[model samples]
Target: MSVNPTPLKPSQIPQEAFDWYDAYAHGAMDRRTFMKKLGTLVAVGYSMTALTSALLPNYALAEQVSFNDPEIIASYEEFASPDGHGKGRGYLVKPTKEIAAFPAVLVIHENRGLNPYVKDVARRLAKAGYLAFAPDALFPVGGYPGNDDAGRALQRELDREKIQQDFVAAARHLKAHALSTGKLGAVGFCFGGYMVNYLAAIDSDLLDAGVPFYGTPAAESLRKNIKAPLLVQLGELDERVNASWPEYEQDLKRYKVDYQMHMYKNAHHGFHNDSTSRYDQANADLAWERTLAFFAKHLT
Candidate 1:
């Protein structure tokens, strides 16, 4: 008889493992170093595969809302991005009931390209009766490449300025979409979150509202020009990202930017990403509820 190894629970993992995983996921640590460190951290009985399985995102868990859900319609669409990669593509979703117009939002992905988790977020927004678009930053380089490590490497090769312009193009395209009511909002995680802040700063009139989940703020020069209301979410234990918060908050207040920030206790970086062991279900739920309400108040 063959025996299967029981899946390790999150509680069994050490905080250092989660921290290292975060660094690895964000591209701060190379795969070789991460694996070597991970080998040392994992318990003796557990295999490297088991440790990695627990650390990396399982896209299967990302499907909170189904792709075939009856309430929403989803598709891939291409849009112009002359200033970016010359062109861009995205996953667009909208309510199936068909209204004359709908409020639109741009869903931004992490350092990796537009993965299933981001696409699912678009569906969730559509199911809530809003038009949502999540663009693939890697489209010009052959899309997501079916895995995060490759996706990250591809993203790193592109000109960051052009990529930023790609997102700017995506925001413009979605806001002016035929089905859009011209009320535009944006929500992004990690790198996407940073993009939200960047968009709000550079193009003051672009976004009516913005939500950045554990992302770094834009440059001070750009941030001073922000016009949109913002909902900033952060994890208390995300020391690397949180280190910039005090200075960022000072600027927000000095400039009188319409913004509110929430730091979830006991949560780590990527806390809202349910696909990984760092996810805090309670914190994620509360943050999402707050995000939806914030959008409703501002986007509508």
Candidate 2:
């Protein structure tokens, strides 16, 4: 009879492993390199599968708000991106309760594309009474392959500039939709967080509010162009992303941008993501509570 190895707790995983997974998740490192590095853990009686299971996202855990929820309606919609990949599609969700018009929010996904977690995020937003749209940057390349590893590999092949344009186009489409009240907010994670920063930087009037979780800050030169209210969320241990915050914060202050930042103690990169081991529930809940309040104060 074959025996299964014990499942490792998130606390058992070393911080180095989490950092390596973050790099691998963002396409900064390839799978072979990531696996080789994890081999060190395997040598210590941990099975390869055990280490991966501890680090990788289990999408099954992502559906906090189900697609069939009676309170919201969800579907995929396409929009034109003349300057981008020419076209794009997004998962759009809206509350079922009737209203003359609803405030809209653009939810952006990480480098791994529009995985289940992001879709569920849109649903959660809708449940809160905001129309939410999450565009798939990987759509132009064939969309998310149902697995993050494949999704990340596919996303790395697309043109970065065009992808930015696609997101901009999606924002415009959501704002202009007949059901929209013309108010728009944006929230993103990792690469998506970077996009939220980029969108706010390039088109000051485009977003009414912006929330970026553990995303890279925009170039200092572009900081002067930002006009939207921003709520920046960072993890205390995310050295790679936090390194740029000091200079970015200085520039935001110099320009007098409306923004606030929260650094969760002892949290690591991707801490807001509940589907992975890096998730920090206490911090994530507090950050999200602040995010919803921030959007309500500005968008409503």
Candidate 3:
């Protein structure tokens, strides 16, 4: 009979010290130099990647998986109004393993449209045991202008009424889905984030929690109509929106709405989108943790 290998024990090694020997063995460092430098840092107790991975295997796996995993099934459902003028909408839906009715989240993509990044976010939410739906906000513009410059140009030409109708249709469709627990929340990035805020202002039935990352504020009249709690994320280094965040907070306070506003230092717009140059891993991770907690508090 073959013998199974013995599992490593944390007590066998110092947790705080970087494992230079392991690094060298894994090819992250050369053997001779790592051995020479290892002794110098042993006394100070430095943390190492190997040590952390060994201690928390789950953390390592979480970091390795992209927020949007393509393998996760995202069934697209299309809808159009009776007038034939409304642009059909597509939503990314991922179910959870939990048997009981679980809370659902609607994820809105940035100006890039309902691309891979948005799908990845939905997958992450599903992995966390929540039903996630990512709707294409740009369906009115022929779906994601493909390039940033062109997308913005198309955004300028979009009709607000058309987009609003699309959102409404998408919401109705998702609310009726079997996976939805009737407790719902919304999250959006960049342009999508702004639209989430807009939806909150208008729709009072389905929204329990809202998270808008670096999105623009809605009109004061609309803000007063929002019935859900909000957790808004902003980036201090994002010149485009950081300066205006104070005004947005003031509006939220003016309406006496339950809200939490966070500004990540040294981060920029699109920090949640890893495909973009403005992505900020630290801030995105923090935002995601907070978002899940918020949904759990309000929806669960």
Candidate 4:
């Protein structure tokens, strides 16, 4: 139940930790390399196991909800992508009793496709009464391999535009589902977060709201085209993602797109994902609460 490295004030963290996190997140450093680099922190008091444990999600944390949870109705469902992209499948989560038409939310994963963590995210959404669909970007290639690294490998090989189409198609299907009220929203992390920007930029008629967590902004030219309201969340310590924010804010303001941005202090990249050490539970929880409120305001 302990968070690895234990929670520390941002000022108390060592420089090596930030280096390792940046390298690992950018793929310049693999798990092994990250561990080797992080070893330095062990000398400073944290155990090697604790350090590693804090960064990657253990099985238990990766899935906080179960399929048999009293109100959960979960299953696999397929949707058609664009002609060339063919079809895709996603883990669908909904409430067991559907009293009326419910707004749907599309959960987009990071570079690793839809893994257990993302599935748990969808289930959490279902608990809030939304029909949640988490589409696997690896689907057209055979779906998530059940391993994060394996899924990342598959995700890297995808046709960029076609992958975008797959998401668009999934949104279309979710919006058309029998129990849907026709209002659709999206929440994406990392790569998926960037996709949220793309979705807002391109799918004006279908997507009504977007919440992109630490994602790259859509191209400036596309900013003016966005019709949905956006709630952008970022970690103050995430340099790579932060680098783009200044210019992105100018575009958002210049374009007049309805949007709100929040940057959490003392947080690094991927702060909202509880499966990793970067999980700033306090900040993550607040961001999530706001996200749900934002989605409710627009989707309902």
Superposed by TM-score, candidate 1 places the C-alpha of residue 250 at a distance from the truth, in angstroms, of 0.6
lDDT of 3 by residue, 1-300 (tens): 955434334343452223443233224555467645645544465333333333322312223335445434456767664432364666555653547556778888765456666766777787776777876666666876555435545655666576666666666666666777888888988777887788788877758889998888877677778889999998876655566678888988887889999989866556676653345688889998999999999988
lDDT at position 221, candidate 3:
77
Per-residue lDDT value at 30 in model 3:
57
Against the reference, the lDDT scores of all candidates come to 0.91, 0.91, 0.67, 0.85
The true-versus-predicted C-alpha distance at residue 280 of model 4, in Å, is 1.2
Per-residue lDDT of candidate 1, residues 31-91 (tens digit): 9999989888655655777788878889899899998999998999999999999999999
Kindly provide the TM-score of model 3 when superposed on the true structure, using C-alpha atoms: 0.71
Q: What residue runs in model 1 are displaced by over 4 Å at the alpha carbon? A: 43-46
Q: List the residue pairs that clash in candidate 1.
A: none
**Order of all candidates by TM-score, from best down to worst?**
2, 1, 4, 3
What's the true lDDT of residue 246 in model 2? 92
Candidate 4 colliding pairs: 54-277
lDDT of 1: 0.91
Please estimate how well model 4 matches the true structure, expressed as its whole-model Cα lDDT.
0.85
Candidate 3 local accuracy as lDDT?
A: 0.67
Model 2 RMSD, rounded to 1 decimal: 1.2
